[model samples]
Target chain A: MELSVIGKYKLLVARLYGELDHHGAGEIREAIDRELMRRGVRNLAMDFTNMGFMDSSGLGLVMGRYKKVSAIGGRLIVCGMNNNIRRIFQMCGLQRIAIVADSLEEGMEELDK
Target chain B: MNKMRLEFLSRSDNERFARTVAAAFMLELDPTVEQLSEVKTAISEAVTNAVIHGYDGSEGIIVLEGTLDKNAVKFSVIDRGIGIRDIEKAREPLYSGKPEMERSGMGFTIMEAFMDSIEVESAPGKGTRVTMTKTVEAEDEG
Candidate 1:
């Protein structure tokens, strides 16, 4: 999985064209970690719009990122999560830690403010 | 497509295979994009547990099997590793054997949430097997 930077927020939108299970989680984690460290940025957006699937590994990735960004006093937001992925997020109570928005623009706005 | 089986090498590898297996098996029902994700997530969690805690992060094999029936899809992962002493404890939220690995211990929680039913069988020092089932929307209600 590869990531692209959007604006001031290093928007790491992973294509997630296929499945996002344990195998892909590591790669995506690596990409996000590198970009976040390089940019010295905390504001992060994970776009799951195109992602076909997510497992617990995906949950671990989200939790790890939340800890990372929180440590640096930055924020992590997720946008365009499908129904199933969204259900996982809600079950894990991730909504309390990470902000889930309708769109990347909304996520960016929430984080920016 | 024929029902399939895949033996996983590492937890990472299991994730990819699990997603594919679940997707392919569930495709028979022509589930929505969302339903596919649920099956994948459930399968991923079961397989991850087999590679990681089920084997204590050591060398072991995880057998993944998938089947599509008239009502729903079923996936099972079997591993002969360090079996869990207490299944109930493992299923609890935030219960992970390897905290240092950055695991949230929410794997089972996610699995149960995504799948319609989950059944686990295990014996200490022998191994563990997790069987999860998900029904398509059309066949969900009685």
Candidate 2:
């Protein structure tokens, strides 16, 4: 439920912590979108290192954000998910639309490449 | 074999609590981390459906019951809210009735994926009950 946005510019790195569920998804989405708008960031890099758990709601949040970022020709990078979280993403076929990175640094690096 | 039942107000906060309760109840089954995660995720989805879809934003009571038999855990989420009009359609992947809230419509899919079997029963003006069972095939290494 906790989110902090750091490293500005066109590519913004968003660090999310705690449980990622339906109740937390709304606030996270609004916060990230608000930051994206305020900074005019075209690319997004999400860090889920501290995320403890996520459900189907988490998948929807990612897909929705991907659609929003892609609409403007931007990309969303996801990284630092545990094995369980990664399995959920894979189950939802998210690899086709989003980039899974090994770390936040790698995700931010993708923005450069 | 053991059985436990809980009834709570249908609320988003209860989703996490429900998951925890299910996971705790399965501790006796000696589920692996993966099995526990899957069961917790499935419970979250089912309880969330009862709160979100069954009640349709209204306040209602969600009943969660868990039973442990051998290596399998069987649980059911029940709510007497505005029942789903179409059970088959509701079970479809990515067919959420509430799109405005950005619901992924993958609740059922997640339940099915994480559990061994799922049975949904509902009728208009009645209630919807989702029963699912998962067998902890892997024993947790002590």
Candidate 3:
């Protein structure tokens, strides 16, 4: 798994590459968490554009990060999800917890709110 | 119907390998991209469950057997690990036994959603077997 963390304004935009399965989830959690702590960033924006596949383990990664970010009064946003990933999110009822935006700009706007 | 069986170690990385195997098995049917993704996702979840939940941190053998009959495919993932005590509760949405591990507990939910039918059989001390089937409407079929 590859993670590119871009610091845009106050949001930490994390772009994930490769498939998001059990193996990828571990690496991503550690990398994202370390970056989040290093920058003291609260709001998180996850970009799944390059992600080709994702199982429920991807859901755990999102929910786990949501818990961490919300604990510190921050919000979590998601964007650029493919149909497969979006269906998983919808089936798991993640729309209530995480804001789904069409683009990175829209996700940043949601975080700003 | 053509059939094949595979046995491998219960490990996280094998999830992708297992999915690839399933996808290859469906190549003969010429499934649509969407149908192929659904089957691969279901297989991934089942294999992952065996590695994480069935074995419960120990190494074990996972048996993946699949068969293609016309336009439908049937497969089973068998693991001789710690079997679930409550099958019904386990099938519920967001009911993961390993909450601390950040498991969303949507494994069964996703499997059921993507496949046409799923049957889970298990005993507390024995093991668990997940058998699922999906029928694809080949684009070339009249």
Best by DockQ: 3
Q: Give the TM-score of candidate 1.
A: 0.83
* Pairs that clash in candidate 3: none
Give the TM-scores of the predictions, in the order they appear.
Answer: 0.83, 0.94, 0.95
* Candidate with the larger TM-score of 1 and 2: 2
lDDT of each: 0.77, 0.87, 0.88
Error of 2 at A20 (Å): 1.1
lDDT of 1 by residue, A29-102 (tens): 88888988876666677778877676666788888988888898877888788787787788778889888987
Per-residue lDDT for B81-105 in model 2, tens only? 9898999999998899998888888
Per-residue lDDT of candidate 3, residues B1-142 (tens digit): 8999999999888999999998998889888878888888999999999989899768999999999998899999999998989999999999999999899999999999999999999998789999999998857547
C-alpha RMSD (angstroms) for model 2: 1.8
Model with the higher lDDT, candidate 1 or 2 = 2
For each candidate, C-alpha RMSD in Å? 3.4, 1.8, 1.8
List clashing residue pairs in candidate 2.
none
Q: Model 3, DockQ value? A: 0.82
lDDT tens string, model 2, A1-113? 44445545467777788888887788889988887788777788778899888998998888888988898788989999998889889977887888789897777776676
TM-score of chain A of each: 0.87, 0.88, 0.90
